[model samples]
Target: MNWCTRCVLPDTRPGIVLDAAGVCSACRAHGTRDEAVDWAARAAAFGELVERTRALDRRWDCVIPVSGGKDSTWQVVTCLEHGLHPLAVTWRTPGRTPLGQQNLDNLISLGVDHVDFTCSPLVERRFLLASLDRFGTTAIPMHLALFNVPLTVAARYDVPLVVWGENSAAEYVGDTAATHRLDAEWVRRYGAVHGTTAADWVSDELTERDLAPYFGPTDAELEAKGIEAVFLGEYLRWDPEMTARVAAEHGFRARDEGPRTGVYAHADIDDDFISIHHHLKWPKFGFTRSFDNLSLEIRNGRLTRDEAIARLRELGDETPYDDIAKFSAYVGIGTDDFFARAERWRNPDVWTRRDDGVWTIEGFLVDDWPWS
Candidate 1:
């Protein structure tokens, strides 16, 4: 697999492009921002958006999709600081941890009306198992609900704006097509829902009514209502550490146990099952959440590529064994069967079985990778 010379990311990752200089597209995109982002101008633009939305004289100025994570807290704080009344909305994950609930309550205490939108547990279970069985991901249902519910709320309430934390396409994949505005096309291409909508999942087991929450107002409907969805990261510089610090100042707590999915002690802590989604990237893409986190650190000058690679080596075989067990029980599937399903989706191009009956990635970035 070809690797980025500048960072640790591989071209094997979807939407990652390695240019002739051996720099990945994400690095190239970040470089442009480092050189060209005029924070003053961006902030002015955001201020204008706030003023324009406020002129509408709506009950709520915006809808902020939140998970009580650091980024969510940061978004809430930023929006409130701008004098925008935001209604924080959460697509309540079935696997939400106790810490998640506490953090969420803390977010609400920061002074914003909140909605904890929960899909029927039965529907979530069926959809999660279906996604795992078919697409090798347990996150499609989560993404669908997370992306949709906020838009639905915006439409229902006639809120003129939806404030999302980051433009993930620009931040992670470096898609040139990424923009500050989010529309239906962008969600289908970059939302990580496999380009399928809630309608695509209809079956004898799940009816149209069962998946109602997953269907947001259509783009045409939203357009007719003059609602706009935008990324807050576009206006302000986004740094995980910075956001974590901001969140901590506002009572957002990190996992006391330590980092769950990646190197961040503050991230992915709200949902227990989210780690399973990140861990699955190992067999399928020959990388883990550490790769993504470390790559970002490399971009931010926090770690050299060599140092990040060493850290990845030290983080060896980051299989979320406990998360897998938790997800298996939640979905009412045996652990053995769950792993069998995961292993079936392992990318053959990135992995090969060794003579000792262990799988290994040939020419892995780390010379002494622990395949066992």
Candidate 2:
């Protein structure tokens, strides 16, 4: 229930630690990035990498994993601006919106080879439901595919570099000094699949072959093949608003409906089901996507802690009802069953049921939270 003095994020968020000053690790990491990071030096290093990859004279100098999000578009624009020919790759979410597809097409029209890697819909459905039933989240399959697809493409195509957008560990988990390589170890730590790999998810229903797209080349294989998967965030500064602006300048469109899951119209908008993954955090960690987005804004000096709190109060009852219905239908489950399974994973430490049969977080940041 401990909230960061600098931002609205709580200590309950996994991998977030509050130091003695009551500042969360993520905010402290952002401070370190601002004060200690030598962005000019990092940019020079990236320039060298770009030159080296270009000199390889391959068909594609890099593989950029993308979801048509602002960050991914920014990644593509940055790579193209650096004169690196990157093959854009998408994992093809089952819940992709029309806007998502349009943005993806626009990114491809930015002039690069693209691959829309689609796993079997049957397998995806089974995996989605299994992930929901077992891990209490529907994002495991999506995360697995997004992480694995581009790397697999890179290894198979002999692309020397895989350009990932950002290091979630550094930005979200306070691991500011994380290795630039997005290898198996990094996946195990920050892949958001509960530290489980594709092999671990094999079940009676989902065979190894059915989950082939989820398995990427191992670190050893990547090393042997001289395939280096790196985070572009390590080389260049990454701010959410800045990235969104860059994307908007490059023909990326924001949602007309606004703020699908968080404070940004541009984020987490690629997949309809992804919001459910973030919404479930309210029950499990006592925070919503608004907390995450607002924390970043506070860290970036766009909002005060009090202002972020007010925004959270305004964004009450962030229960992705339509998304839940669509996802439930896709996974052949009822809406009642969906919530019932989500309820099973509610963190007892963060939530308490009231006498009136409503769940509430006792030490929540918002004093008058509209708990539904």
Candidate 3:
């Protein structure tokens, strides 16, 4: 439960490495970018990639997977700015917020051809519930669809390139080697699926046919089609605040209230279940969306350790009771059952219950903040 000395990230976060100097690997990785990256050369390489892909005989030059979030809007706009014809693809979440729908419509108004893919909600709900019961997350199916559907469309449409956003390994967890590219192996290992394939989820109630949409292209299939995927962040400096501001100028709307767990005013608004999914992580890992956002701000030089810790204390725990009722019903569970499952997943090693029935974690750097 130890925390990074330089940022708000906790050591409990999986795959995180803290150096002898006490800076988290993510911070160390950002330092490398500041000191060593050549943005101009990366941008040139991106331009060349676009040119090469556009030269292919397909009607669309590339596929851009989108969720109408700020990052996705930025991706679509970036492709358009580079004179590349990108077909925007969205795998519709179970609960689409009005604001999310509005922003998506606005993105479509930007003149890019868009496709919204939706699987059978009945099957999706079953998978969602199964994931929740087994992994304490309702996002597994969504993650699988997000990663697979775009590739499915690209293959069907004969597009040879798919442009993705930042490499999570490089930007979030500090695997610099993966910063330059994203492949199927990387997607399964680090992306939403996290090595759990759709086939692994098949059961008596859920058949292989019902899970077909979650199956991404095989490596051989991708190679046969000459398809490639690259991260846009590698070509440009990735600043979330800057991207959100730019997206706002193009009609992207921020949430009226900030998200249930994160400081960002305009992220993960497409689904109500997102907050619940993130909240579920707290019991297992002893951190939440607030920690994630604050760590990013610290790395980007927007907040000091004290400031970030103070803000986290003010925000408090981000349990999404507000949306729990609706979300539980959506997944065919009762609110009591939802709470029971959430409590069941709380790792005893990371949490302790007080006499008053309040739960807390120790070893968080925030507890040792100088001002606190």
**What's model 1's TM-score?**
0.98
Q: In model 1, where do residues sit more than 4 Å from their true spots?
A: none
Expressed as tens digits, the lDDT of each residue in 303-339 for candidate 1 is 9999998999888888888988999998899999999
lDDT of 2 at 345: 92
Q: Residue-wise lDDT of candidate 2 within 236-328, one digit each (tens)? A: 998889999999999999999898998999898889888999998888898888899999998889999999999988888889999999988
Please give, for residues 1-372, the per-residue lDDT of candidate 3 as tens digits.
778898888887766889898889998989788678889998999999988887885899889999898999999999999888889999998788888899999988987999999999899989988888888777789888998999999888888999998788888888887636666678776875657988899999899999999988876888799988788998888888988988998989998877645888888787877888788878888888888888899988999988998998787657788778879888788999999988888889888777777776766555742221
| Candidate number that wins on lDDT, 2 or 3 | 2
Q: After superposition, how far is residue 77 of candidate 1 from its true place, in Å?
A: 0.4
**Model 2: residues with Cα > 4 Å off, grouped in runs:** none
**How do these models rank on TM-score, best leading?**
2, 1, 3
Candidate 3, superposed: residue stretches over 4 Å from native:
368-372
